[model samples]
Target: MSLPPRAHQLHVLACHACGMVLEDALDSTGHGRCPRCTAVLHRRRPNSIARAWALLIAGLLFYIPANVLPVMFTSRLGSGSDNTILQGVIEFWHGGSYGVALVIFIASVVVPCSKFVILGLLLITVQRRSAWARRERARLYRLVELVGYWSMLDVLVVAIVAALVKFQSLSDIEPRSGILFFGMVVILTMLSAMQFDPRLIWDSEDT
Candidate 1:
């Protein structure tokens, strides 16, 4: 059977230098490069908008629990303690780790939520064919892409604490619901970043 029109068009734009056609580029690790110029020919991911929406929605759903539940449980000297993201931030602030706390709050909470909201707004604007500040919208999309990975900071912290604080009975750190939810939020945002297409913004400008 013949491929769809869009797929056929993508294939026609294959990089002559790399001999990579767009049809085979949708895999997670797959990329198409120009054989001659070594330039990227085309991104193979399909249904980028739909994938982004799915990820964004999932992230939004998980963000609630990531903030509400305890992210870490600390057991030291037979005394146990649990901290949510906000509680941890407050502790860090009061303990004079203000900078660290700020970084954690922004990366673990603010950035992800901001990306989701910004991307959703951009998508909605584009879908509505709103011609307002196309350039600005593109810039926002780039920002979202840049900040998407930082959401993993919380997960990294949890993993590191889990690894380093392995005192077994005397003192130990355990991952909590918030950590898992935070991880999901990060993954979902990353997926959203990957799925979003900046070209759509430009396409709106042309229309």
Candidate 2:
């Protein structure tokens, strides 16, 4: 009996111990354990570059307007004001909601931007097959994945304020252009993360 020529290609593997699927291709040694569960793993998928590219591009596109447009509108006692994402953060900070402001700053502004930059770096590095700081790159990818959803905090806040502060003539809250852009940013980053193939980092090292 002979194995197929493609059988040696790196592919996603499943762990027999914890039942967790490894995102990267199996080690050439024909035996590798799951990073999460330390269980023996098997090949599952061969490549993930195309999906990752699409996601990163989408995220890059949405990153633009997330910062440019106004995220919320507030009307108080017949006086209305619209604030961009940064302005809202500043308002919260000036109004003594420092903690809330900080959270929003990190989640809405910093995290999304950072995620994009980091993912972009990783993609570029993988494409160039650069092996420097392999561990650091992997760590950065995990961080991006973890913080990706946090960017939606702004959207959540908008929804909450819109629902709770509906005083009509007295006070009213409305979604702004930034909200849409910000939402797209969140969605795009998530898509990027989903599209990204973490296994590539390790594969580059072997090559």
Candidate 3:
């Protein structure tokens, strides 16, 4: 008897949670619910394209305020000032903590914006059913997903800085509206990436 092909090429849906094959389940429910894990199974995620587009657009919109607004408020000896993400990075860079500044700039600004552009390109190419570099497109999806969570590094940095300064006698730090906006952007992008079905890249044979 011939063994089945690799698991991913099965052309069958499975329980995303419990690893249960769901091809048979489709005959029963329009969207089958896994008996083992209760996850809703689909040959393809329902409205995957639409949902990802919506989330991506929202993330893009939020990206504006995330950068423009101040992310932190700092007061030392009764003199206080607000710092946006770029401002903080510039200050850090000038203050000789270039490494931390670079990390913050990349994680906070570059990563988020690039994720938007990358997701946008993926969605468009998938919609057009463009067969260009199908394998590489799948790889791109993986790369974006891997880096998505790292954008939270900026938030972590802010929180740490705030905590450290909270107890200082003449200096204190508090997060600003921009940080909240940036967090929303990160979350929306993550959801967008999750909503995209990488399998779509492999659905068609490469030209």
Candidate 4:
């Protein structure tokens, strides 16, 4: 069976922000401004793979310290304790809040790391002009885009907990440097995914 032609064959590009279709699309450097919303248009994102790799690498670098350092500091009657991400997850598991623990572990650790891996693979394959599994690769890109934002779930939880669990002298919960690093990880990975242009996956003639 013959497959349907892709949008690129028509020499048009869709505006991501406003869904406007511009004909004769050739603004790859993002200099062409969209007439409707004034958003810059790029046929293919400029330096997409490189920018994505940079952000992904930064996210990975931050991931280490974020897991090592304490994300939360707690004090009860002047006695202070620090808890890292894994420590908190384990604590939650031991305390029988399995659902929340699982959610945190997946959202905070698995999602971001998997996103990095997936995006890295996509970039490598696109650069090599691999014709293997073009449709599947495009699906993978959509999956990455969908889940990238969810990595922030743990960060939001931490912020909310810190906000709610405050006490003057009896007990207190405050965010530490680890969560800040983790936040950066989430943000960087999301940005990385956004910077990646899925159109590159099908750039080769065979694809």
Best by TM-score: 4
lDDT of 2 by residue, 1-207 (tens): 973433225344456457665555544556666788776665433345567677767777776777787888999999999889899889889999999999989988789879878988998898888888988999999998887898888899899998899898999999988788789878977887866777677765445
lDDT minimum window of 10 residues, candidate 1:
3-12
TM-score of each: 0.79, 0.78, 0.89, 0.90
lDDT, ranked from best to worst: 4, 3, 1, 2
* Candidate-wise lDDT, in order: 0.80, 0.78, 0.86, 0.86
Q: Candidate 4: list runs displaced more than 4 Å.
A: 25-31
1-207 per-residue lDDT for model 3 (tens digits): 974463345656677777787455475657668878887776677788999999999999999999899999999988899999999889989999999988888898888888998899999999988889987888889999988899998888889988888746588999999999999999999999999988787665533
Off by over 4 Å in 1: 1-45
User: Which residue pairs collide in model 4, if any?
Assistant: none
Candidate 1 lDDT, 58-108, residue by residue in tens: 989998998999999999999999989889889999999989999998997
Model 4 lDDT tens row, 121-196:
9989988999889899999899988888887877787798889988878889999999899999989988998999
| RMSD list, candidates in order | 7.4, 7.4, 3.2, 2.4
Higher-ranked by TM-score: 2 or 4: 4
lDDT of 3 at 142: 90
Per-residue lDDT of 77 in model 1: 91
